[model samples]
Structure formats: structure tokens, C-alpha cells
Target: MVARTTDTPVGRVKPCRLIGLEQHHDERGSLSIVESEWTTGFPIRRIYYLHNTRTGTARGAHAHRALEQLFVAAHGSFTVKVDDGHRQRAYRLDDPGTGLYVGPMVWRDITDFSDDSVCLVLASEHYDETDYYRDYAAFLEDVRRQP
Candidate 1:
């Protein structure tokens, strides 16, 4: 299991398990599987991958309103910053088997990518333009209004 780190109380971040995918190694090569149905709790509905063509380019300057995400550095390495509108933490993802489960209400930024890095994101919901909060100020206000 991946380690959990939160600046504020642990109650705030609500990180779920970072499950290791099943890997098969053979003379030909290695293969890994990530099954949505096998997921313990979160039901994945969407899957996408982020490949940074530029070496230092960063992505994900916003947070999701209701979607939960699990990010994995399938190849190479990168850093993921997660903030709950109060405290923030950065996690380095270098292992293909490891992933970071980012719950809803957290602002996430993925950056510091090594060359050839590929980020695979598994989301609990399908793409909905209304579910995204692109502005930081608006995100903070929305979090404050939440009971």
C-alpha cells in the first residue's frame, strides 16, 4: 500500500487505497491489468492518459466537483500535488504499480514530469463540463460553502 500524508487532520484528505495492478512477466515482455470491476470501492467510469510532450509542462490546474480520480505514472515519473483548499501535499509517482487516489473537493496539479512520462487517470465519473472547477478562488468559495 502507498503511504498517506496530509498536512491537516487525516479526516480532510480521505485518501483511498492505491491498489497494485496484476502484472505478468514473461520472456516476451510484461503486462499489467487495471480492471474497473475489480476496484474495491470506487466505480470507474472514465479512463484517460496524459502525456506531456514538453519536458516541464504542467497540467491539472483545477479540481473536480463530484468526480474522484486515481492517477498513475504508467511510464517514467511525475509529481502530483493535491490540496483540499486548506492544506496541500505532493506525491511522487515513479512506480507503475502505484497510484494516488484523489478524492473529490481536492485541487490537483500534475507536474515535474521526466521525459517519456505518461500519466493514466481513472475517474469515477464520465466527463461532464459542469463538474470541473477551473478557478482556484471559485473552488475555495465552494469548499467554504460546503457543510
Candidate 2:
């Protein structure tokens, strides 16, 4: 895995990928499955998909405290903005075979849809409202004070 620079508030971005998952296609359609230990370093505990998004609409305007996520544009195209409280990075995702692994402590927002965009998220944990930092100002201070 390699880290790439993003337009996020954080100055650096770490890229990672898990193995043992494949996209299967046939005349019927397509299917994908994530198995345990598939990701080399990050372990997934939950999986979710977002669909039926309208063009120019945006979603996800919060940051996670402990959960890590891999965001994939399953259908169509969309842009994701990642903020690490110091720097922010933007990613354009349109490929079904690729994904952007976002670590904890980063604020993320998905937008700029191409009319048929669908986002699939692989999470390291289940939903927890307390684990999220929705306020940008607070997030920035938290990252700044982190040792």
C-alpha cells in the first residue's frame, strides 16, 4: 500500500488495501464479498452501501473517532473530500475495482455525483454516534492536541 497526498486538512494521507475479495461478473449481474482478514492491516466489522443519490448532492459531513473506513464508488462517479483537521484532500472515484481507505480522525464528505453514483463503505466498526465528531472546529482542536 502507498500513501497519497489529499486536499484534506491533514497534510498527509495513508493508503491501504485488503486482499481476498473479488468482483464477480456474469450475464445476471455482479457481486462482491469481503471476508475476515481480507484487509491486511485493518479489520472490517461492518459493511454498508449507499445508493439512489441525486446529481450534485452531498453526503457525509462528519469525522469518525475510532472507526476506519474504505469508501468505494460502486457505480457512476463521485468526489470525496477528506479532512484530517489540519489539511483537506479531495478524491475522484469512478472505478468499481478501486477504493479509498480513510483512517480515523478524518472528516469526510461525498459529493459531485454523476447521476448514478453509489457508494459502498466497509467499516471497521458498527454505528456509534459518540464516536463521531461532527463539529469541524472541535475536530481541528482535537487533532492539534493529539500527541
Evaluated against the true structure, the overall lDDT of model 2 is 0.73
lDDT of 2 by residue, 1-147 (tens): 222374223423343332334679899987765554564246888889888887667899988887888877778878777777667667788877667777788888888878787888888898999999989899888888876
lDDT of each: 0.77, 0.73
Collision count for each candidate, in order: 0, 11
lDDT of 1 at 40: 26
lDDT by residue (tens digit), candidate 1, 1-147:
223366343115465335677788899988877777575247889989988647778999998877888888899888887777777777888888777778878888888888899999999999998999999999999887766
Off by over 4 Å in 1: 1-13, 26-28
lDDT of model 2, residue 86: 64
